[model samples]
Target: MEEVLKKFKPRVVSTGIKELDEMMGSGLLDDSTLLVIYDASSFGWTIGVQVFRRMIELGGFGVITSYSFPISLLEKYALTMQYDFLRDGAEGNLAIVDVIGSIYNLNVNLPFVYYPGSIDSETFLAKMEAVYRRIMKERADSRKPVGISVTVDALPDLFGEDVAMRILRRNLLMKELALMREERERPINILLLNRERASRRFIEWLSQYAEHIVEFRSTSISGVERMIARKSLLPSFTPSEAEFRFEHGNIEIRPL
Candidate 1:
C-alpha cells in the first residue's frame, strides 16, 4: 500500500475486499452508514479492523473506536492483520478513541489514543469530533477520512438506551438525513454490532437508519463463515451472500 489514495469517485470508497466491493455495486457509497451485525463468538469484529486498515491503505484517514473493546485488545489481536495502529497514529494516518478505557478506567498507554476523561456522553462525542475536526483541517491534503465503531451494541450499556439513542439520533440518524439533503462527502461510517448483546427492538431501530446491513454467521461443522447482505441502499447492489474463510490474514470470499 502506498501513502496516497488511488483514483476513486468522490462519493464511493472500497471495502478493501475485491469480491465484497464488487457485491456492493463497485464500492461503498460515501453517504451510507454500514451496520455489520455479527453472530456471537464469530470472527466478524476482525472484519471491521480489516476494513479500517484498508481505508488507510487507500490514502484515507480512519478512527477506530469501541465501547466494549479496548485499544490493548485490538492491538493484540490485530498483530497478524498487518496493521500497526501506534505507528500509523504517529504518522498522522489514523487514530483510536478508547471508550472502554476512558469510562471504565482501564490502562491503555497509546500515544495518539484519545479518552473522554469524563462519563458524559456529550463529552465523549466532543472528543470524537475533535479528532474529526483536526483531520478536516487538512484541507490542502487529499486523504479521505472514515469512522469505525467495533462495538456499537455496548453504547447503551454506558449511558442507557435513551441517552445513547439521543446521541445517535443527533449524530448518526441525523447524519443519515443530512446525507439525503446534500451530497457532500462526509466521513464514511462502519459500525459493528453483536446481535446477541443488543435487544431486537434496538437492533431493528438502528437497522432502519443504516444504508447497508451485513450479517455474519459461522458454522460449527466447518471453518467457513457466511457474510450475508440483509439490507443495502446501493442502487446496483445485487449479490446477496459471501462465503469466506480466514486464510493467513486474508478473507477469501466466494460471492453467492
Candidate 2:
C-alpha cells in the first residue's frame, strides 16, 4: 500500500481584535465557517465587518450574507474601517450576495449578500446552499483557497426557537459535507447578541456544532457604569472582566 500525505491549508488570522481573537487562539481558521449572534447592541455586526476587512487585507476574498441591515450600511462600515476594495485593487477579491429581494443579488466584486423581509427555514437554507456552492466553485476555478464568514444578524427572529434548531442542524450537515469533500474545512463562529439566562439550552445546542464558543454579557459595575465582559472559551481564565465602551463608531475595551 502507498502512503499519501495530506496537504495542509493555511489558517485564517483575525484582524487584531485582541480579546475576541485570543478566545479563538489567534482567530478564525481559513476555509472555516462561524456564526455570530448579537443583540441590536452587542456590536456583533461591527466585529463581523472588522473580520471581513482583515480577510481582504490578507489577500483573501470574502462574502457577507446579511439577514438584516442594508447593503449600504455594510459598505459604509467597510469604508470606515479603511477597506478600499477599489483603490487597493481588491475589488475582484471581494464579493457580496444580497438577498434583499426574492432572488438573491450576488455582488462578487463587493462581497456582500442582502436578504429582504423575513426568511423562512426552507428559503434560507436554499439560498445558503446556493452561496456555498458558488464559493466552492469560485475557489476551484481560481485554484486558490478562500475563507468565508457568515453573519446572521438575528437568529431567534429569523427562525424562532424550533425552526432555528432545525436550521442549525442543517448547518451541521453542511459542515459534514464540506469536511467529506476534502477540498476545504469548515470552521464557524456564532455570535449571540443578547445575554439571557433562558437561552442556555439554545446555546448548548449550538455548542455541539461549534468548535469554539463565546458569550458576551453586559454588566453594570458600581462606579464603572455599564461594561461588557466575556466568558472565555478556556475555563481556567475565570471570565476576565473588562470595561467596554463604544465611541467614535468603534468598540474599545479597557481593563477593569
Cα lDDT of model 1 by residue, 107-164, tens digit: 5676567676666876766666665556556431556667788789988888888888
- Tell me how many residue pairs clash in candidate 2: 29
Consecutive 10-residue window with the lowest summed lDDT within model 2? 1-10
Every model's Cα RMSD, please? 5.7, 5.5
> What is the Å distance of residue 91 in model 2 from its true position?
0.6
lDDT of 2 by residue, 45-142 (tens): 45555555555555555554544444556556556555553443333555444554333443333433333324467777776667656764653234
Report residue 135 deviation for candidate 1 (angstroms). Answer: 5.2
TM-score of each: 0.84, 0.65
